[model samples]
Target: MLLTAVAPAVWGTTYYVTTEYLPPDRPLLAGVLRALPAGLLLVALTRRRPHGVWWWRSLLLGTLNIGAFFALLFIAAYRLPGGVAATVGAVQPLLVAGLSAGLLGDRLTARTVLTGLTGVLGVGLLVVQPGARLDGLGIAAAAGSAVVMATGVVLSKRWPAPAPLLAVTGWQLVAGGTVLLPVALLVEGPPPSSLSAGNVLGYAYLTLIGAAVAYTLWFRGIRELPPTNVTFLTLLSPTVATIVGWLALGQDLGPLQVVGGVLILGSLVFAQLRRRPSPAPVRAAGGPAAVQDLNA
Candidate 1:
């Protein structure tokens, strides 16, 4: 739980890392760097390779979770106002809750639904500021990214890989990075002629610690916990991002953001409290055969 809790907090650094450390014109390059090398390193350490259905599954999961999602998210950030983009991303927890119920057959308690809604509303209240123009295309892209990510999360829980968590994450990163490399080269062009030391350090941190470590921990948490519960952790990301932006980048957090943060955290706690207990076992009335079968 501690690891799970810490992972998203670490992930909150993504916006700052991208804006501050990475070259501005190469979002795809940033994605590639974040994924490929870290993936290869994990694969080398594990010395494990996936085949057949696992290969296809990993590719699909990677495309949705990383490649397509990252592409759309970066585009949205570039084209849309930050607050609008963030509001679109903030809808993910609700999407995850709904998808988990349909796809994973998880019980969708009213409390869970309400909590997810509250989290979304809180994030919206926190991030949307006056004078921010909503770009329709960017909003669509951001919302699309959230939907794609939510699908990946649900599918991951439904069809988990038959390997250690790190190995699975490694393969997904490899697949995602491979998918992104060509796009990066074609669309963004070769990275700028010169690289800054700060950029290198930031890229390295995002690749090794952010993408590799954070994702491995996140997927492990998702497999072990309820999808809704896992997604609730995302609330932490925006809050952390807001703080990092303010302190590190001199971005301001208005009163609305603070209130929104409170609501999101409160919703998470409420959802945790509303967790349903396991159903009690029923006694068999017919015979011992029934009892044995039931036990089996």
Candidate 2:
């Protein structure tokens, strides 16, 4: 879990890096670069490709988790302020809980529901500001991103990969990057003619750290942990982003933000705590009851 938590924490740096170093208004290009290079490098390193079913599965998961998610996120970022986008996207955990309950047959407990709601509230307090304008399309995009991401999380848990962890991660990234490449070329035109040192460094950071390292840990978590449990950790992304902004960029960190951070952390902890089941009655190994237990 600690390793998994690092993914979102790394992601939190994206906003600052993008603003400070990346080319302006090139989200698709950024997405492509972040996903493809890391993916190709992983694939080359692992030298593993998807078998019969996984090609489609990789494509679908890639589209849902990375390609479509990035496109919608781009729209939301363009139309909505950062706070509004973050607040809207905070519904991811709740959505994941619901999907897990329906698809994975996980229990829909009150604690889980409340924790998810509290997470949204916390994120709202942490980021959403007063007088934030709403665009219907942008709101839709944000909500869609949450839904697709939630579905991706649940589906990934549902479909355990046959390939090694890094190989599977690489396949998804490659597929996602492939999906984005044409769209980026058509929509945003070609890449910028000249990239500064900051641009190269920023892209390198995002590709190597954000996509490659972060996503490997994330998928490993999904393979090992419950879907809802993993989703709760996602709340950390925005919280970390806010802190990065405050410390690195000198953004405001008001009292409300502090409370919000506390709430987010509380929810994360609450979700991870599970009630221990009562122990089975002790019995002799060679007794009739033990024979009955073995028979049953």
Report backbone clashes per prediction.
Answer: 0, 0
* TM-scores, each model vs. reference: 0.90, 0.94
* Candidate 2: tens digits of C-alpha lDDT, residues 116-190: 999989999999888999999999999999999899999999999988999999999999999989999998999
Residue lDDT tens for model 1, 202-272: 99998999888999998998889877788788778877888898898888777888889899889877765
Off by over 4 Å in 2: 279-296
Report the alpha-carbon TM-score of model 1 versus the true structure.
Answer: 0.90
Q: Which ten residues in a row have the lowest lDDT in candidate 1?
A: 268-277
